[model samples]
Target chain A: MALNIKPLSDRVVIEPAAAETKTASGIYIPETAKEKPQKGTVVAVGKGNKDHDMTVKVGDEVLYGKYAGTELKLEGKDYLIMREDDILAIV
Target chain B: MALNIKPLSDRVVIEPAAAETKTASGIYIPETAKEKPQKGTVVAVGKGNKDHDMTVKVGDEVLYGKYAGTELKLEGKDYLIMREDDILAIV
Candidate 1:
């Protein structure tokens, strides 16, 4: 999907993985038990600032801090915008 | 005081302002009521990485987030080490 907004500085736009609704054993999980997913696909990246280089590219799956990033919606889909440093690693 | 350690990769060593121990009226404040100081002096700064430049200089007074940085002790003094981005502004 094309992104309408571009993040400035060292920020990136990510498409977070959908929250799990059930356990692998088929047990239903409650909303309160659902933790934010730390994994996402890089959708858009910024031109890095002078001190750092952009390490992850579009389409890279990455893990980030559980509480990292700002939440936003684009075309009714949830997305996260955060600095690349918030991403812990590329998976 | 001299800092024996040098920060790396956009990190900075800051000497945090002492926490307020009493109210303006001279009433003693409880430990739980004392909030972390958001101000500090830049003691050391890392060389800017490829993407960004060092905006602050040594001895510059700056404001940072209350919970920002890692705590450490050197020569019986407290210090915080954090990324320059964590500093909100130079005052």
Candidate 2:
């Protein structure tokens, strides 16, 4: 089923990467010990305005600023909504 | 003399307002003790890209984000170069 959310002009909805639950050294970390992820998969894109163009399509994995975007929730899943300019790169 | 700076697409050149030199209580503040001003006069505006249109013209007073834009120097005068989106409003 498609995501029911539709972002506004120049905005996109991203499904953030799951937070890390363990350390590189294989130490287990509690859910409360994790940092918010900076990477995500774009699920929805807005038709950009005259000065900007929508570059990323659905399913593209992107990297964004640490403090970019607003938090959103739908069907018990977390998402982020931000302008395309907030995305740093497509990874 | 006309300012010789020309900002690129969607960018603008602004002359920041002079920093406050006196406190509300009439106390003189040193130049080294003033915060950067958030208000400015638009000196140059870019021809926006296909996705955006230029909304501000030269000579418009504007309010911008506290930390928006890059600093520039021309003819010994200070200016800021930023995108139109950085401007919060025109006053």
TM-score of chain A of each: 0.80, 0.82
Fraction of native Cα contacts reproduced by each candidate: 0.05, 0.05
Task: Write one digit per residue (lDDT tens) for candidate 2, span B1-91.
Answer: 5587778899999998777533222322223324887667899988988766777789876656667999999888999999987765454
lDDT scores in order: 0.71, 0.72
lDDT of 1 by residue, A4-63 (tens): 454555778899866664434453423543577777789888667766789999988777
Model 1 deviation from native, Cα RMSD in Å: 11.4
Instruction: Spell out the clash pairs found in candidate 1.
Output: A49-B51, A50-B50, A50-B51, A50-B52, A51-B49, A51-B51, A51-B52, A52-B51
**lDDT for position A38 in model 1:** 71
The interface root-mean-square deviations, each candidate in sequence, come to: 16.0, 17.3
Q: Model 2, range A1-91, lDDT digits (tens) per residue?
A: 5565545457788988777633334534235535877777898886766667899999988778878976644455677778899998877
Give TM-scores for every candidate, taking all chains together and pairing residue i with residue i. Answer: 0.44, 0.45
Which residue runs does candidate 2 get wrong by more than 4 Å?
A1-91, B21-34
* DockQ, each predicted model: 0.04, 0.04
